[model samples]
Target: MSKFIIITGGVVSSLGKGISGASIGKLLQLNGLKVNMIKCDPYINVDPGTMSPYQHGEVFVTTDGAEADLDLGHYERFLDVNMTRANTNTAGSIYQTVIDKERRGEYLGATVQVIPHITNEIKRRFTAFENEVDVSIIEIGGTVGDIESLPFLEAARQLRLEKGPKNVICVHVTLVPYIAVAQELKTKPTQHSVNKLREVGIEPSMLICRTEKPLSLHLREKISLFCSVPTQAVIECADAKSIYHVPENFYKQKVDEQIIDLLGLTPKQKVDPKWFEFFDKAMTPSKSVKIAVAGKYSELQDAYKSISEALRHAGMNNDAKVEIVFVNTEKDNVEEKLKTADGILIPGGFGGRGVDGKIATIKYAREHKIPFLGICLGMQCTVIEAARNLCGLHDANSTEFDPTTKDPVVDLTPQQKNVVYKGGTMRLGNYTADLEEGSLARKLYGKDQIVERHRHRYEFNPAYVKQLRDTGLKVSGWHEGVLPEIVERTDHPYFIAVQFHPEFGSRPLRPHPLFDGLIKAGLKRKENK
Candidate 1:
C-alpha cells in the first residue's frame, strides 16, 4: 500500500514549502522508500510554458518534456529523480481534463461542479501515483484560505478518508514572523492559518514553523496548544546557509522521525552515504570560477533558477565554486560587465528588449576567444551575431525581433506559422538530433545521436546555413531537414550554442557534459591567466 504526504503553506507564499517537501522526500529516500513528488499549482494556466518569466519565474522542463513549476526543479535536484508529465498539473489542467471527459459523455450529462467533478479529478491525480511508489509527497501551491486552493484542499481531505488515516499525513508550513518593536516571534498568524485549514475539513498532523531566529520552547508550546498538534510535531525551520542544507536541518529537528512515527513505517536504512558525500563536496570547494549570465530577467534570480543550479552542479563536478554575475543586458553595458569573466552565458528569453546588448556580448565572446554558451533565444542571437559580423550581412536578424530585416537569419518554423493559441503551443518537449561524427557536440555527449528538451518556436534559417557554414562556423547538430540544433566555432577555444535547454537536464551528482565542458574551459582560462 502506498502512503501519501501532502505539504501546504500558510501565512504567506514563498515560505519554502517546496524545499520542505523536497527535504522530507529526501529523508524518505534515505530510509529506503521509493519516494515520488508531485506539484499542485493553483493557477489557471495549463502550464508555465507560455507564462512570462516576470509573472511566474522559470518554467522548469521535465525529462518527458513537460514544462512544470519551478518547484519541480527543486524536487529533481533534491530527490535526484527524473520527473515526468504526470508529476505536474495545474487547476487549469485539472479543469480541462474534467471538461474533456464531460464533453465525451463520461459524466453522462450530469452538470459538473467543483465538489464531485473538479475535486474528484484532483484526487484521481493523487491516486494515479499509488501503485508506482512507496510514498508520494504532494506540494500544494498558494497559501491556505485562498479561493483558488479550496478544491485542492478538499481533495486532499477526501483522499485521507479514502486511503484511511494511517496512510495519509498533512504537513502544513507556516511563518513565525518576528517584530522588531516587541523583539519576539508571533504565533497568531500560524494559529489563524491552522484554524483556517481546519475549517476546510482537514487538520495538519505536523506544523513546520518558518522563523528567522531559533524557535523557543515557549513558542513551540503555544503553537502546539493553538494548532492542535503534539509539542514535538511543531518543528522549527531556521534559515540555512544554502538550500542544500535543508535535509540535514530537518533531520536535526527530527521532522523525518516524526513523519516516520506518524506514518507507522519502519526504515530499511537511516542514512544515505552518497548524499552525505555530495553535500560535503558541495560545501567545501578548493577553488572558484566566475561565469557571467547575460539575461533580460536578471533582476530576479528565480527567473533563471535552473540555470543557476546547473552552473552549481558543474562547479561541484569541477571542484570549483561557481560565482554567477548577473548582467542585465537591458540596462548594463554588456561588454564592460563581462570583460573580466572567465566564461559567458546568454540564457533564453522572449521579445527584443535586450537583443542589441546580447548581440554585442556574443560578438565580444567570439572575437576574444572566451568560452561561451548560448541557449534557446541565446542560440538564435549567436547565429544572428555571426551572420551580421562574419558573413557581412549587415541587416541580419531574427524575424521575431525585426521582421523587415534584409537578411532573416532566424525565422519561425513552418509548423508554428498558423498557430493562433499562444499558450502551450510551441515545439515543446523532446526531439532527437543527428550529431556530426567528429563534431564538438558528439565528443562532449559521447553519442552520435542526442535527444534534448526544446521550448522554442524559432529556428536558424536554412537559406543562411550554407552561407554561415562557409564562413568557418560549424553546424555540429541538426534536426530532420535543415534545421540547425547546435552551432559551434571551430576557430574559438570553446564557443558552442544549442537551441535546446541543457540546464533542465543537469543534476548535482551527474552534471550535464555541456556545462562540465564550459566550466572546464573556464577553469583552464583561470589557470592560464
Candidate 2:
C-alpha cells in the first residue's frame, strides 16, 4: 500500500501549496520510490475546461483526456510522470458521481447525506491508486477556513484516522509574514491557522512556513511550540529564483528523510544530494532572447503557465535565458508590436476575440522570415491567414470565427460538429502524428512518428488542404492521413504550427522538440541580426 502525504493550506490562499507538495514529491522520487501525486480541487466545475483562464489559470489536460486543475501540471513536471484522469478530483466530479448513484437507488432507499456519501467518495479518490505506487501526495485546494474546502478537509481528517498516523501524514503550508515597519517576522497568523486545522481534527505533522525571509531559530521554535508541531518539522520555504530550486531547498532541510521516518517507508535506493541538475541549469545562463507571446490571454501570465515553462526549459538546455514579452492580441498594430521580438509565438485560446491580431502577426513573421511558432487555435489561424493572403481567398476564415465564409480554411472536426455540451468535449489527450520525410518537423523530432497531447475542438479543414499547399503551405504532419497535425511554409526560414499542445509534454531535463526548435531558431535570429 502507498503511504499518503496530505498537504493543506491555511490563513489564506495562493500560498504555494502546489509547489510545496511537488517539491516533496520530487525528493521522494529521487530515492527510487515510485511516487504519484493527485490534486483535490474545491471548485464545483466538473473540470476546468469551461472556466475562464483569467479565473483559474491554465486548464491542464492529462494523458487520458482529463481537463484537470493546473496543479497537476506542477506534479507531472516535478516528478516527470504522466498524470491521468484519476489524478484530478474536484468537488463537481465527486458530487456528480454521488447524485448519479442516488438516481440509480444505490443507497438502499436511505436519504443520502453529505458526510457518509460525499466524504466517502472523496476518500475513494485518495485510496483508489494506493497499491499501485509507493507514495501519493494529495494537495487540497483553497484555504483551510474557506467554505468550499469544508468537505475535503473533513474527509482528510477521517482518512488520517482510518489509515493510522504512521500510514498518513498532514503537512500544513501557512504564511509567516514579515512586517516591514516592525522589522520583525510574525508568527501569530500561523498559530491561528494551525488552531483552525486542529479544530477540524487534523493535527498536521509538519508546518511549512512560507515567508519572504528565512525563519530564525527563535521564530521556528515559537511556531512549533504554539502550533503543537515538532521543532524539526518546522520547515522554512523562502522565495527562490526558480521553482525547480524548491526541491533542492527542501532536500537541504532533509524534509524527505523526516517524512520517510514518520511514515516508516523503506527507500528503494539511496537518496542523492546532487539532485540539483535541473536547478543548476536554471541558475546559470549566458545569453537571452526576447520571445513575444502574443495571445488572447496575454494580460494574465498564469493563463499561459505551461507554455512559458516549456520555453524556460528549452532556454535552460540552450544555455540562454528566455525573456517572455506578453502582447495583447486584442490591441492594435500587432505586427509592429512583434517586430522587435527575436521570436513570435501565438498560443492556444478559444473564441475569435483576438484572431485578427494573431493572423496579422503570422503574416508579419512569414513575410519577414522571423522565427515563429503557433499552437492549437494559433495553428488554425495560421491556415486561415495563408488562405486569405497566398491563396487569394479574400473571405478566408475559420468556422469558429465566420462559419459561413466563402473559404472555411479551418473548421470543427467531424466528431466535434455535434458535441453540444461544452465540458470535456474536445479532441484531447495523447495522439500520434506521422511526419513527412525531409519536413522541418521530421528533422526536429528526428523520428518518423511522434505522440503529443491535444485539447482543441477545431482543426485544419481538409477540403482546403490542396488549395493552401498549392500556394506554398506545406502540410508536413498528419493523423490518419486525413487530419493535419502540423503545418510549415516552404518560403520561410522557420514558420511552424502544430494542432497539439507540445508544451504539456515538455520536461526540464528533456524539453519538447518543438519548443527547443523554436528557441534554437530564436537564438539564430538574435545572432544574425
Candidate 3:
C-alpha cells in the first residue's frame, strides 16, 4: 500500500514550500522507500507552457513530454528521479477533465459540482502512481486561504478518510518571520495560518516553520501549543547557506523518523549520508570560473532556474565555484558586459527581442576564442552569425526575426509550418541525435548517441548547413534527415552549441556531460589567463 504526504504553504507566498517538499522527498527516498512527487497548482491555465517566464519561471519538461511547473525540477534533482506528466496537476486540468467527462455523458446526466467532481479529479493526481511507489509527496501551490487552492485542499482533506489516517501525512509549511526591532520571532502568523487550514478540515500533522534564525525550544513549544502539534513536530527550518543541504538539515530533526512513524513504514535501509557529503563538497571548492549567460529574461533569476542549477551541478563536478553573470542583451551593452567572461552562453528564448545583441555576443565569443555555448534559439543565432559573417551572407536571418529575409538561415520545420496553437505546440520532450566521432559533443558525452529535451519552434535551415560547415563550423550532432542538433567551431577552443536543452537532464550528483564540459572549459580558460 502507498502512503501520501500533503504539503501546503501558509501566511505568505514564496515561502520555499518547494524546497521543503523536495527535502522531505529526498529523506524518504534515502530511507529505502520508493518515493514520488506531485505538484498541484491552482491556476486556470492548462499548464505554464504558455505563461511568460517572468510570470511563472521556466516550464520544466518531463521525459514523457509533459510541461510542468519549475518545482518539479527540484523534486527530480533532489530525488534523482525523472518525473512524468502524471506527477503534475492544475485546477485548469482538473476542471477541464471534469468538463470533458460531462460533455461525453460520462457523468450520467448528473449536475456536476466542485465537491466530488473537481476534487475527485484532483485526488486522481495524488493516487496516480500509488501502487508504483511507497509514498508520494504532493505540494499544493498558492497560499492557505486563497480561493484558487480550495478544491485541492478539500481533496487533500478527504484523502485521510479514503486512505485511512495512517496512510496520509499532512505537512504544512508556514512562515516565522523575525523582527529585529522586537528582538523576537513572531508566531501569530503561523498560528493564524494553521487556523485557516483547520477551517478547511485538514489539521496539519507537522509544522515546518520557515525561520531566518534557529528557533529556540521555547519558541517551538509556543508554536506547538498554538498550532496543535507536538513540540517535536514543530520542525524549525532555519535558512540554509545552500538549498542542497536542506535534506541534511531536516534529518537532524528526525523528520524522516516522524514521517515513517506516522505512515507506519518499516525501514527499507539505513538513511544514506551521501547528501551530507554532497553538501560538503559543494560548500568547499578548489577554484572558481565565471560564465556569462545572455538572454532577454535575465533580470529574474528564476526565469532560467534550471540553467543556473545545472551550472552549479557542473561546478560541483569540477570542484570549482561557478559565478553566473547574467548579461541582459535587451538593455545592457552586449560587448562591454561580456568582455571579462571566461565563457559565453546563449540560452533559449522566443521572439526577436534581443537578436542583434545575441548575435554580437556570439561574434565576440567566436572571434575572441572564448568557450561558448548556445541552445535552441542560441544555436539558430550561431547559424545566422556564421552565415552572415563567415560566409558573407549579409542578408542571413531567421524567419522568426525577419519573415521576408532573403537568406532564411533559420525557419520552421515542415510539421510546424501550419501549426495554430502557441502553448505545448513546439518540438518538445526527448529527441535523439547521433554524435560525430571525435567531435566535441561525442567526446563530452562519451557516446555516439544522446537524448535531450527541446522547446522551440524555429530550426536551423538545413540548406545553410553546408554553407556554414564549409566556413569551419562543424555539425557535430545530427538527427533524422541530417537535421543538426549540435554545432561547434573547430577553430575555437571548447565552443559548442545545441538545439536541445541539456540543463533539464543535468543533476547535482551526476552533472550532464555538456554542462560539466562547459565548466571544465571555463576552468581551463581561467588557468590559461
Q: lDDT (0-100) at residue 476 of candidate 2? A: 97
Residue lDDT tens for model 2, 479-529: 989899999988887889999999999898889998999999999999999
RMSD of 3: 1.0
TM-score of 1: 0.97
Q: Could you tell me how far off, in angstroms, the CA of residue 217 lies in candidate 2 after the best superposition?
A: 0.7
Candidate order (TM-score): 3, 2, 1
lDDT of 1 at 150: 90
Stretches off by above 4 angstroms in model 1 are none
Compared with the true structure, what per-residue lDDT tens digits does model 3 show for residues 349-403? 9889988889999999999988998988889999999999999999999999999
TM of each candidate vs. truth: 0.97, 0.98, 0.99
Cα misplacement distance, residue 78 of candidate 1 (Å): 1.4
